[model samples]
Target: MNSSAGRDFRVVAVQPQWHAQDFTSAGRFRAWMRSQLELARPHIAGDRPTLVVLTELNGLPLVLRGAGWATRLGTFRRAATALFVVRLPRTLPLLLRERVSPIRALQLADADTNAELYLRTCQALAREYGVYLCCGSAPLPRYYRQGRRVRRVPGVLTNQTVILAPDGHLIGATNKVHLTPDEQTGGVDLTPGDLNDMHVYPTPVGDLGVAISLDAFREDVLGHLGAQGCTVLLQPDANGAPWTSLEGLPPDPAQLRDQPLAWLDSSWKATTGGRVRYAVNPMVVGNLLDMTFDGQSAITGAAHEGQPQSYALTGPRGGFLALMPWVETGPPEQLRETGRQLAAGSGHPHENLYRTGVLSADLHLPPSRVTPPTPTAHEEALAALLNGEGEWPRPTRSGRPAAWLALLGLIASLTWARRRRDGDRGRACAPGQRPR
Candidate 1:
């Protein structure tokens, strides 16, 4: 591949701390974001259109800061319990009600005042910095326009990742398709966006694709993006406690390299066969109320010929990693070979580490010939099942009889218990004259 065929652009991924105190004041949150962007500005090189990526749910603090005492006191576990199990029976009614879903209501009540502030701040930062910005992820209410008024519908919320061009234009918005089990249990009740709907946003550097944390884990999502000619992947993540164990593990360089590399291999390899050349994951750091975020923000690529390697930041440090001017590299086979060497410990783990604070590299775009395998019929069927499509198996008429019997049994047991309770009360009343 000709070196001149490649394009050069700067990309920065940031990991930031979200303190409880910051959420108490909206100005503090905006100030924090501005400071982070200013810090990243010195690292950005060249006049090439740069792309800056942030973590998921980063904007949620704005909503939290504006929420009432009830919501402020509600932890992730408590919110999940109330939203999922407690509200399951009321799902239908919530959906039917006009803008009355609990999640929507909470977001509306808390975020209504600050949502615009958060978005405007991001847009302002992007424009001021002259870079494309993946502002971060937030669980926001979905709205529809009715005549002159725009209203949020009930029972619908989207975990949205917004992309802003350097000119402050809204380039693209990708909603998360895969929701974690906890998100479902927490009464998040977010409507999943279509994977097919995600499109590549063209930039001077290359085409960019954005995915939320869990969404990045899905091969289908990455595969589709690859097919669409996206050469760069930006994932904003917020995988915190319980789901990730960051308890006692030291942030040793080895541990950092191993953990994130183990997870990044699939996506990196997928990029080898797809149009994606590089992937940047900026994860959340620090504790948010009850949840502690694990931060190992990284940039991985098959850019080098010897082996595909990752440049990662360990521990819960908040910083940015920049990659400038992408170059075209060798075939996908070289990437596979690189992976093998790394796994075998032949490749140097720390070769790409620039310093404690920054990691800069010349990214290589995968050869055009590398193509992902086409899905087979069986795989397609399994995909449908995994995506929750098609009709589920229904109970037969014979099963209905058993269900009816169970219901009757429950009713009879309740009635008997009630009569026994009444008899005991009557006997107690009659014996009242004799005093125990």
Candidate 2:
């Protein structure tokens, strides 16, 4: 464990109310972000190093400026799908032609200008705030070196999360490895990165790890981070109602309830085993086109006696900062035992507050052991499947041939039975049934 494990740190999770007009100019978006920082300033009182987390795809608005389709369709879901469908034929050729060429496909979408502006704004904000900042996730085309030349595969993009240091220098970045079906159909066509390649950023308070939106729902991702001895887990999300569907169907109503929070709590405990001292989830709020985001940003940790506690923002909009005390982790054996008990369905001993509006809290962080857990073969296989490296075991194909043979036999038997019945009926009717 790092010597600074016992040091306290303050973190501000900003849940901003986004507007379409803000994307008209980079300055407008910066101004909106600055306002959110200002709102969080009062709550962030401490000399300790602080980290500010923004929501997933918070930079999307800036990247989508001047999109003609956005103006006409007036909804992100519809606009994105329509744009992709309209240009699909043309897009396929470019994708196939440039499949091996080192060229960014952003020009086809006309998003280069906005992408540059969005990145610049994030760097500026990190420098201005002088805090470790998670600049949120953005769908950007990235180039990598192949042999001696730098190249990008066309028509492929990664939803990347950038981490900036206090001095505005790039520290770490990771791409969202899990893409929802809606995102895939909406022209996002994101390339998933390996979870093992995830960066663990060293911070003053603890080692921090990031899981963007849907990635957070995967237990393997969280477990891998915990095994790496990450003390803080940052999850940036943009959860909303009216989920985008390829079939134009409405979302399940149960999804809009408090079920997400329950899932978050359960997943955290199951993966981290109280090893990660702090878990912060910041979600985006407000309406973007027709989608309305639900902002229930939260900070959760275990209490002194191994009970979980959480401070959440239940409102639809706003910001919250939590000043958390650093507590040294317990032994590895104890953490494993705690995890086992939790897995046995022992409920939480304490209640958490579902807070609304602006809120602040000074909570104690649970102690965790930094010993990296050695995964078994089964665990490794599961991780590989989740990371898309290995395919899930399908039922044996050997049964297929047998099934087909059985079907053929049944068909032949039925044919013979029909023929015999017809022959018998004809003979009886022709020879004797006429006399009766």
Candidate 3:
């Protein structure tokens, strides 16, 4: 709906709030998402973001929440459940919804296998939504637990993404390269892929790359994407604020200190000189006990002649940043040349083939859209933590006297109970001539 050819392109990036608790029920979650979409409608209607990206588990969370009986049972039993049975049936039902499982939501392997189905979903969403969607990574079938020849039917990782046109056409996809230890340890059981081989998609807007949360932190991954003719990078992240508990008050003073921002600065600077754009959509809030996505969705880089400029969006509750319009200023060949030149200029002691060019952008440029927010109590606490303003309520040490008393009381009570029990047993045994 909104065009960005002549003036600075309006590239709006939004980090939608995510919830794992609601994932099991798609219908309820869809309605909730529609409401969230409504909150974002102002941006969509105003900016017409050619490529709109939601955080990981956007719609799938609902499917995950309302998981079919099969997934629930398989997950519960920790067994190799048939992927096709939970997803695709031997026969296609008149209604596709009844048959396809979350595992078969969209085919992820080999671009040819079910690429059209994948594309159609993207196309449909694009058409219906009137915007392009850059999907986050989802799980795809990879060899899990060596030597276990479980039926490796159709399946996808939960961290995968599907990019769609405003008309919902499939554009391109990037699987998450890095998996957290917990994820790897969990039944997710996804193997690490060669991130150095990054994929780029040439879209109506520009060449874009999708990088998931942990992968986004990798310098090699970002550099690879930049080198592979990718100018726009979409990072749908799952990282969030670490809280003590799900229901526990939003991160206490000490807890809020855990948010990581250093990696972001390094990641952005990694592809600075190149004509690439990077956008990160991290889930800020969610239902998991320890996991809570902290929204910091942003768009950076304008592929100008000499240097590329960058801008980031700072807002609360998944705010929207201005659309940094798509402009074809640097060709892939030029980018390679620039990369070579920059790498050569920055002669280091070590010969690193991956040291591409670096450029500094005037990121202070005005954000296209800005909305001020009223901080919640939790946010206020987090702000204190960020500012290093508040003191962590130190744990008060318990008195030693109390511990001694407790130990002595416990010994006394146990001894008395033991003696009483023994006496009763002896009396019973004597009267009955049998052990009681």
Candidate 4:
């Protein structure tokens, strides 16, 4: 049993630069997503499966897809306000039923539409390429299967990561057990997932684990997934601030690692000790609805050791197999400058970081991962057509949809949702309060 001959798996982290237009419409969103997948296709060969992981929030922009005004607005505050006014009739109910503010209600209302746009696109791509696609993470009302029907759980929403098999079937979904500061109260206010709910989905490559963004930083989530026998870990990241900025000081600031160094810890440190052999961190780049995210995608192996305490993304360091080209490894000032440029919204600077690229490594399946799993518990049948699959899901609440008028609120609902969620903690700036 030669390990070299058993090289049947590859992992490619797709660092995508998302913009408002990419999610302008269902067709446009699919096109943009497909183009990114095309970039990863080169890493596939020999009929061996490749795991393509897109960065977090890579598809979350769908909330703004059909809403022209939201995308055109400079800040999400004005956008949310406009959208709220237009969709007050629909948003009003959600606000009351869910006992949430305007922002959360907007997000809740648009869940079904965004879910459809995201799931449909990813599934098609997974089937077309015949690769295992970690469709990245999105905040949507909790979707569960009811016999052949797929329905959203009324008020519940989670930042969920979904995985699709080569056959385009949903293999598994893991929720972000831990929420970042920005995702909690007075923020997006999404429900945090419980650790008990984590699932390790088996793939051609191995038992796969997906930890969305911040989840990779904590041991609670990593340790639990490791205990479940994950060999490959995917940390789909959407670093809220710039990639070079220092991490906020926790209670114990004395032991903090700065920026990429903290991310590197997610590399070797996040493997569930030696149980998880490899980790892939795909990062999102670009400013979506004014909330910017930027970072270098990275892949790490457990076998490589004795790396420099500090290393740059110029090449592989420590156990990193590949890190996308990122030269802004700097003193926070660089990130601030990038922010300034973004504020101007004029020309692109450090433009390479926003280009779609793949950081991939082909590896021999470890002995532990070679054995495929025997079917266990009840697997949901590849969901039924589910009320509507072929058509772009309508956002209307009721009635024979008026071609023009009925749909106005629909677009505004989604637009407002994204604007609220896209805003830094639900508001760009408070009344008379300056934004840093």
Candidate 5:
């Protein structure tokens, strides 16, 4: 790896499909990994680029998706059959399997447990891969409140982002501040930290800022990256439906109003010259039906006033790899001139008072950070609701007709049971005489 930096470099972003069970066994996953490295290895060996970035969950999800049971037999059948082919029995113990074996409680679901296993597996994969891999976040254990000043005991859960470099070295990581609603209060009942925060990993190439899905949606988050000297931003996301080619589809004329990309263009024009690399690698949902990932991976980079460049690879509805070159852009700076030019401009007729140029709002300001304020319990709860957390509300106890009918039915059933018992007692007493 190139430990020092200079110009004339290349970068490969690997977008591997990670949904189904094809990548479960050490052999299958390692094969996929080898293929990805083979495709991009030349660049690294040739010293074209010193870094290789991989998407999150490149191994574990494939295994979990493939695990299953045999019909009529009590024993669970491994979903992936390719395990023995690749010598995985020897490797399974090395895997991160905390979630698969945790003490099951009523509050924890299979999904939560699997997520934990996924995290453990990721750590193991990073150690073995020996590349700069941005393993995404998994939840960690935190204190949860049951209700009314009662606190549940703390234990580890799955949550948080992880990054590993080549040779299995850990870099920096950031926990997601803005979780999807289900991840917030109630469902998993997690407490969210402040927003507008980021973790900057200073690599040999340059500083990289990593964020989760919703974190990218905030303008403040973007600002935080720009101000902190981050030249590239990486997002490991599982967002909307995975897309195939947009070919043969007609543009919607009614929806032809200006969109955000256009605004982005204008913003770039107004701003000082600086380059920002934004990459989004979302898990492709379509290819998972057969318990497999459709490595429909894509990457997009936006340069100031330049055509947005993107690279993608979608294939055989399973795991595939894509490697693309990326040019690193530095932060902005002011213009300078020689002494002779300065002297010449001092007496120039056009340089009388003010400089003649188009005024740009973006150029006038300094960059800032995006950090959200700490939230109160009530506010957090409401935010959780917005994020799709909380229990389903029950029917109100107000005396509406339905409520009254339910109440009446319940009372009638209780009264009838009591009367039946009393009648039996009365019959016995009448036959015997006044009972002692």
Candidate 6:
């Protein structure tokens, strides 16, 4: 929330610390979040419009808080199973009422509890701080709110990104429209968000946009939101890869020496198109069960896109407003040296990676574009397809078993996290940075 006399707006990016202990109790989670928000209070007291942002999946681990005895389990699957056993009384009613698979019922039960905790905690904090807040993405099914009650809309869970106003009311929400191979095929089975209905929300500073993780890389989703006159883009992230890996990067003569920053294109390059003036990428860092999320959070400007990029891809001319220190250094290959070797090389406990970064900067923002907020061509086409303007393709008999296979694969994988190799999922967006 830092501001200067002539600045048009301000951004406070909270690169949050994620750990099971924080969400073990309602008081702990709220207190942890409140302290995080307190870091923004210094920047928010002025007339300048300020927006506070958290990283993607910032609230996803809240599930561990509500799921009974989950924090005590050694791995995710074990915790989930323990959760079912611990909450059998509540879950039995859901099973009888919905008659869905045990897995599906578990997801619904999860959505029923954790989503509210995430929303209420964020809403209350936004109001207390009196600042606009983007609470990152949470995994929840489609839900409707009716006078303090949240009801499920009978859909698979989606990575839902929500923006809250200074008064603490929800401004708008968007879901992840692109699914990684793991998200779709993984047992989690997240639902991809539709593009046609996506739109920008009005903020005091300008129109705000939400593109959680891979959705920021999507042409359709970005096109639709850009069409709606979005000025600032929020690409909240929790990359499950090492921050410095250079896997799968497209060659830029400029990037061959340092390919890590190439992945910033998901947001930075997208802004050079002129519609988005600024992009805020706040990332979560820490271990969730055996999974890890690491990254250096940043706020970059489009006007500086023409400037020579820094290794961090930031500066005043269209570079970074602020960039956090990276967790690892040196070449991606050296860093990727065998898993055991890599693990042994680092004496610092992974818990040492849980540094909470609070970055605030005053930005001289542009006037919002005068274009009418309208659906982009991609959105229209998608709407048409969904409206039955085109035929709905039926799944083949061969495709029928895919769900069961994905579920089995997910269960098998989740059953033993120690055996799961570390690659870049968070880094997958970065190209070959994800390990093979």
Give the candidate number with the greatest lDDT: 4
Task: Estimate TM-scores for all models.
Answer: 0.61, 0.62, 0.49, 0.80, 0.45, 0.74
Residue lDDT tens for model 3, 54-82 = 55545433324324443443232111222
Candidate 1 per-residue lDDT over residues 251-296, each given as its tens digit: 2212322333344443445444444677777765554555545435
lDDT sort, best first: 4, 6, 1, 2, 3, 5
Q: What lDDT tens digits, residue by residue, belong to model 4 across residues 305-383?
A: 4343333322334666776765445555665465445532436664324534887887666445433333222123223
Top of the candidates by TM-score: 4
The clash tally of candidate 5 reads: 22
Error of 1 at 17 (Å): 1.3
**How accurate locally is residue 281 in candidate 5, as Cα lDDT from 0 to 100?**
43
Query: How many angstroms is residue 329 displaced in model 4 relative to the true structure, after the best TM-score fit?
Result: 6.8
For each predicted model, how many residue pairs clash, with residues at least 3 apart or on different chains? 5, 2, 51, 2, 22, 16
Compared with the true structure, all predictions reach lDDT values of 0.52, 0.51, 0.39, 0.66, 0.36, 0.61
lDDT of 2 by residue, 74-93 (tens): 66534543443343333333
> Model 3, residue 285: what's the lDDT?
37
Instruction: Return whichever of 1 and 3 wins on lDDT.
Output: 1
Stretches of candidate 3 off by over 4 Å are 1-9, 45-49, 59-124, 140-158, 243-258, 270-275, 302-436
**RMSD of candidate 1 to true structure, Å:** 17.4
Question: Model 6 lDDT vs. the true structure?
Answer: 0.61
Comparing 2 with 3 on lDDT, the higher-scoring candidate is: 2
What TM-score would you give candidate 2 relative to the actual structure?
A: 0.62
User: Pairing residues by index, what is the TM-score of model 3?
Assistant: 0.49
Taking the tens digit of each residue's C-alpha lDDT, what string does model 6 give over 256-325?
3222364565666676556577788888776667555566677777645434444332332355667676
